[model samples]
Target: MTKESTPNDVTLAEPIEQEVEAHSEDNKVSEQEKKKFEKREKERKHLVSKLAQGNMDHLLTRVASVLNHYQETRNSDITLQTRYWEVFQSDIYNGSVIDPKDMYKLERLTSIARARAKIQNEFKMFLADEEVQVSRRSRQETEKEIQLATKPEIPLISMYCDESGKTGNFAIVGSLWVINKARQTQVRDHFSKWKTEKGLSAKDEFHFTEMKKHQLDLYKEFFDEVIKNSDALGFKAVVVDKTKIKRPIDEIIMDLHYQVVHQGIEHEVSNGRLALPRIVNFFKDEEDGQEALYETKLKQHLHSQFRLAFDDQLTLDLFNSVPSFQNVYIQMADLYTGCISRVLNHPKQGEGNHKDHFAEYVLELLRLDLGAKNDQSQDFAMVHFFE
Candidate 1:
């Protein structure tokens, strides 16, 4: 038997029933949100585990490298880690962040900072245990490597190389070093202007072999301009006497070329003309009919030398071979190398011929008398006769 409800009871039950339904709906929403949060937490933990185990993604690795460089270079007590973490805490949690990406980056970088600190502390402990000796130079080199790997900018110098007398009594490798892009432009402009005045187009390349008696004055003037701009221009040459080579020329030519470039850089660094942490871009005149990739081999040789030579941190960038006719700098290298080769290879043709006169004039300008071996330290120029 059911009792019939009164109107007053119905009104009271209506309000209570609506409240219960609303409460149930709220509980459902809360449960769904909880599941979503749990999934996100699980994913985050997996990501963190991966990062902790040295499975850093590219972004993490890059950020870690950058932080490492800052630690090495910046002398501060607070550290980038502390400053960045404070910002992360204040801005991210407050929801006052400008970009959402900042949230993830700040968190990741802070983690990297922590990891780096831990690794360094452990390394110190390891060194103590092993009684290892780390020289100041080694530490500086490591810092340089970090900077080179992570920094956005670096100082650059261009080296234009050309070979001469490869088949003759003496093989000479000459290179013209231009400091920075501004100097490269300045040199090109000056050379172009001189060529225009001499009724020559951009296509008219300068070569020692092409020099005539009539062009001696022009050639002298050209070299004079070069000497005048000695601050921006440097010349280095390595002359190898073929008589001393026990092996085939091809077997040793690469090394000879490498020595010329390497010693040239060393000389500049020693003289304080070029500073450290520099990259050299090497451009060589194209070799005719050689099956070997000369530029690639030269680049590899240079890399190996830098890797083995503890003293040098100088890096090599673009090692390209281009036509001598296309580049004025390479042509200049050719002219210089050719002059040395002619003087050294054919001693009998010393004074009478135009080539001899021009070579002699160049040697005089360099303040070097023609000899079997000569080196000029003045005016940012060096010529070495390899023993």
Candidate 2:
């Protein structure tokens, strides 16, 4: 059982050579020697055949044991010579005794171990690279998800409108579309700051005609800011010639409101700007006379006809209501109508008046013309004069 003291202590290769030498006997060779030689050759061939077929599992187990032993003695971070000297010099194989032949076996095993480790290292590198690639792909996908979640959904469009002049006279309805809530708040805050700083009454309306020189200057500053950021705003104006329509005053006003709404929707649709939910319209809701009744009728008309008019069912309803002076945009709409009515109603009367060409200032601010309608209009705003 002891490896060093075993009867088969001779090397496996040496015994075969010794057997061939012993069977040679005399130079002529005896029959017994021939028979023994033939028998040993048959035994060697049978052992080889058995190993190739049935002992393969046993061979594989030996190969696995050698590979594991080699790995235990070797570290990739160190060279084979450094690893052998550092790690394996004092180690014994399965606690067995060693001989001269065992040294030869160890040298051969070391060569096999080096070859096995090289292939295994390649496999480890492949797996590591694949893991890094997977991590990078996951990071990119997570970044895209974050972008989708954080981006804004949709912006809003606010239409603030007012009518100037009587229903019987040359009336004008002016509307301004504030782009988004931020821009809308920006305008309101600017107006509020100026009004408070100037000590203006909260109840005192923002009527442009009644504004003094200093007030006009304030108005000019606000209008200039809006004009500078005009791309973020849309303005519309419609002047009605009462002489051309024989309808009642209320009826005429309702019709003009309808025209303005229609024009606004058409312009928006043609411009491919229908991403928002609804068009918010805050009109000068006068509660006097039949104005409320006419408004009710107008609402019903728009509700029934909006989709039919513009061929869009996806757009939200037009919010038409009366906003107080507290709403700065409604005040802006009021200012626009008042200025527009002055030019259209009294073209010759303001000829000698020093404040005669105030309409020119209005035009410069709003960039509105009463007649032009372009499908692919380069201008961001529109002014329609309806006779």
Largest TM-score belongs to which candidate? 1
Q: Where does model 1 exceed 4 Å of error?
A: 1-152, 292-294, 310-312, 372-374
**Cα misplacement distance, residue 98 of candidate 1 (Å):** 22
Q: Give the per-residue lDDT digits (tens) of candidate 1, residues 1-387.
A: 998999998999998999999999999999999997687655443433322212334443333322322332222212434333442345554423446666564555446445444333422211111221323234455555445335454466777888877679888888888864446555667777788888988788779988888988888888888887778878888887888878777656677677877788778888888777766666677778865565567679878876676245666654556666636778778878888888888774434688888888887887765574756555577787767
Q: Which one wins on lDDT? A: 1
Q: Which stretches of candidate 2 lie over 4 Å from their true place?
A: 1-155, 167-169, 197-204, 212-214, 269-282, 287-291, 311-320, 348-355, 369-378
Across residues 1-387, which tens digit of lDDT does each residue of candidate 2 receive? 755655465567687887778866553468777787687655433332321111223332233222222332222212222233322333533323566655654435455444434433422211113443345245455454344334333333556667776733687677777654445445555656677777876565666667665566666665676676665567666667787777777666666676776677567666775553443333443444545566678777666666676454323223335434455566666677767676666564534342334555766655554333222122555655564
Candidate 2 whole-model C-alpha lDDT, 0 to 1: 0.52
Q: How far is candidate 2 from the true structure (C-alpha RMSD, Å)?
A: 38.2
How far out, in Å, is residue 293 in model 1? 3.6
Indicate the residue-level lDDT of 217 in model 1: 84
Looking at candidate 2, what is the lDDT of residue 375?
A: 23
